[model samples]
Target: MGTVEDYLGGLRPEQAHALRRVVELARGLAPDAEEGTSYGMPALLVGGRPLIGVTAAARHLSLFPFSPAVVAAVAPDLEGFSLSKGTIRFTPEAPLPDAVVEQVVRLRRAELGA
Candidate 1:
């Protein structure tokens, strides 16, 4: 998709809804955030730094926090989940916790001192 809205529009209702939740959570936590694409996935930026991203994959949809520390802090609750340095892999069937996402955004913002 050329844009984040186009990407969201292309998914099934449930998947789109999950992606929308991530977007809403990111925006709510960082009102001045900008929306764009990073590495072909939709991303939200806080103070010009990448804060979060949502991407569609063959097996699952992913919402990446873009912070290794944030992912590490929440690793306990993320057992059995696949993750990389800045990305967490989850299916659209499992919606992301808004609270967790907000915490991540808050932590990242604090790290950025913005």
Candidate 2:
């Protein structure tokens, strides 16, 4: 994708809306991050490194901090949400909490040394 907007545009309204909120929140935390992609997924790039990525899957929305450690550190707060080694999965109807997202973004930034 040329930019995150292109990725978000292809999503369902609620999914796109949720991902937008994610990108907005991440932007507030890392002003240096730019709209970009990592491994073909829409992402926020910090120092040219993918800090965080938000996208829609077939059945749920996903957030990738691109670090398994970040996902592990935040797993306790996620509770009912699905978690992989480096991803958090949720639905737009039950979007991730802003506070949790804030932590994820900060941790990813720290991990990236951004």
For each candidate, the alpha-carbon lDDT, in order, equals 0.78, 0.92
Mind sharing the TM-score for model 1? 0.86
Residue lDDT tens for model 1, 1-114? 465677889988878888888788778878998878666677877666777788877788887777789888877777777878888777777766777777777877777776
Predicted model with the maximum lDDT: 2
* Candidate 2 off by > 4 Å: none
Question: Please, what are the lDDT tens digits per residue for candidate 2 over residues 18-84?
Answer: 8899889999999998988998898999989999988798899999999999999999999999999
Q: Once model 1 is optimally superposed onto the true structure by TM-score, how far is the C-alpha of residue 86 displaced, in angstroms?
A: 1.7
